[model samples]
Target: MRVAFNVIDETIWFIDRPHEPWTVQAEARAAGRLDDERLRLAVRSALARHPMARARQAPWRFWQPGFAWEIMEEPQVDALSIVDCPDDAALARIRSDLYGHPVPLATSPPLRVRLAHHAAGDVVLLGVNHAASDGLGTLRLLASIVRGYAGAPDPVPDVDPLAVRDLRTPLALDGLPGRIRHAAALVTELRRPKARIAPERAGDGPGYGFHLVRLDAGDTPALGSRRPPGATVNDVLLAALHLAIAEWNAEHGAPCERIGVMMPVNLRPPERRNEVVGNFSSFVTVATDPEDRGRPETTVAAVTAQSRRVKAGGPPGALVDVLATPLPRPLLLKEVTWGLLPFVLERGLDTAVLSNLGRLGEPLSFGADAGDVAEVWFSPPARMPVGLALGAVTIGRWLHLSFRYRHPLFDPGAAARFATRYVGALDRLAA
Candidate 1:
């Protein structure tokens, strides 16, 4: 049986940014098979293997099986041309475009794939509507496509999106008021003054250069040296970001005690393994104060502890409950007023976001005899107010970092500098 899930307030925020397109491009050596028949067969097999591609959603459902594919075969359709712009600019354009083209709930598809084929090979651009599928979902679809091409029995049967239980049930946290105050105090004490970096303007050109930096597995040991007990690479990355913001603030002469980092929490559990679909995420802010004179390890430990407390206290679930309630117009307005609590809590917070997807395990290899999968990375949406986004994923032993920023808010030089500083901070912690 299917049930229509009411769109939450967070989903409304997603709807407002219509131009923030979530796209992924996979470029590989074509091996001479770029015919229409092959493409159709590939897509048909992909659809069959990735059942989520064909699932449809009503007002209450969270996803629809809509997908589109286009094959471009012109000399101008170079692989470089397909992904020329820096991911951040591409992301910015999507968000800007989204603001203008607010996609209504009814017309948007759950997925889209555009293929640009050249004499060299092929580049597959997979775009998913953010309201439905996320990075994990995209990877799942791609894996299924690869497997289907190889004639593997479907990896796993598709679970109806509606059938997944919402673990975000409201919980009673009677003493939560004090804990919330303590969390706020921790943020305040750790708050750092940060200046917003201005991004470069989009040039007359159609695309920009894209580059990547992968930290080696050997480097992990060095970095782990300084990590306090219970601190993972994620904690180290968060610390680096905190330091970067502090330095940026120092360089720009901005207040150093007001910056905040938005951290997304994945709410999925082990039992719901196959229910890997849609935006199953919520967030908490880690406030930093550069003026605080604690060692980097201590700062991270404090932040981690606060995060643990918040997670244990279950405020995220409470938020889900509050937002999910079906209220009348007056009550909805009241809820909106109350929802401002996040903004209030985050006032003077730096508009940066950090997300870590950890490792992706083995590359999804179709029965292809060639090209081993090397690395994978994803850049989540970085809309305005939140002008910078940092995403990391470890494919095998290589840690891939994708830093996305609004073009108008950061120049390539600044971005490069920021990346270098972040790496340096990580190295410092490792040492």
Candidate 2:
């Protein structure tokens, strides 16, 4: 079956540059190496279960109506590989290369899977084109892969992609009027002056630089304990992020007037909960006024209010309604890139993007003989201006964080230093 690309997919596809491809990645550290043949069969089985993830972009010319996708029975290109890593350094190098490379759309099943075998442990990495699916969707696919490896059945039945996309956001709106009103409110709020991370150096080059950190199960209680009366763990983490950015900027002699975080909200309704092949997300910009800066308690309080408003169908949901409008592809792409996002990006309304994937929900097991997953983490692409993307996910009780930064905006050393600051901020919150 052939499915048409939705507006969100169209926008992502239009702006996908070779230098900074829109990609989402997940990595799992396991106890032992996996069987190559079994792993390959598992990936193929997973793709078959989720047909939309197996789609290949259909060819189009300027004269065509719009771009569409053709689902294939099997992958046209080889999608999984097993690499031997004699040491930790070799494993690290493999990770950088996998995350840096973009999945080709011309091929069926736009996903890459690599297993690195190291003496200490084995690691499984999955990278999918963001144009194909968001972080959560990637996780669902990964879970299916693990299930297939364990001789489980298909996780879900195939559904219409457009139907899933329609259920995205603005769940409370009456119609066009409510959409326009909320969208305008969001734009007005974003028009205010905002602060951006002052780069440690200069350059916008190809590839992503990333660092990973794990918080043991013992620290999970501390992370969940001290939230304000109604604040969730996410609110606390958001607060910690804002505080870290402020202090890092202060120590480096940069002014932080206002800090903003572009957070992606999942919009799948209960009926469509099992569907996991498309991007069903909307972005909400959570910001801190100057008065709320420099203190963890104050920042948490402020973030809690804003994020609460967002949950209640506030300003951040504007894009959900706006993008769903039925307009021609070329005009829609131009307006989103040149009109809407240009204003937001130029004003620094979004300093960074934080995607908290919450939890894996279930453990990943590759049968009794294969390695068992010890830890897992994911990272979204670090596109410039908002040059950093911070991701958090939990396995059992342990929290795993990934810091992905764009090229020269953050060198390896700078990314490490910034990550340290973030950890310290979270520690203060836990304390």
Which candidate has the highest TM-score of all?
2
**For candidate 2, which ten residues in a row score worst on lDDT?**
163-172
Candidate 2, residues 1-431: lDDT per residue as tens digits? 77877656776776676777788888777677677888789888888777667988988775465678888888898899899998877877787788788888888988899988877667778988887888888888887877787786654745655456544343447777777776676676577667778789656668787888888635644376644567787887798889888888888888888888888877776565535777777777788977897567778889989888877765454555666655554544454554556655468467888999886656787767665778787988867667889999888878899999887678878888999999888877753
Candidate 1, residues 1-431: lDDT per residue as tens digits? Answer: 23333233234333234343333222222333233444445555655444344443434222332222111121111111132233445543532332223223343234554444433334344545555555566656655554555556554535655445353342223445544554454455334344454344433221222234578856666344546567667777787788777776567665555456767666565564323555565556665555441566656765666577666764432234333443334434544554664466434445687877777655544356423344455556555545677777776678887776655556567777778877876776653
Best by lDDT: 2
Error of 1 at 369 (Å): 4.1
Tell me the deviation in Å of residue 177 in model 1.
10
Off by over 4 Å in 1: 1-15, 19-52, 55-105, 116-123, 157-159, 165-167, 170-211, 222-226, 273-275, 291-294, 310-322, 325-350
Question: Lowest-lDDT window of 10 residues in candidate 1?
Answer: 72-81
TM-score of each: 0.71, 0.92
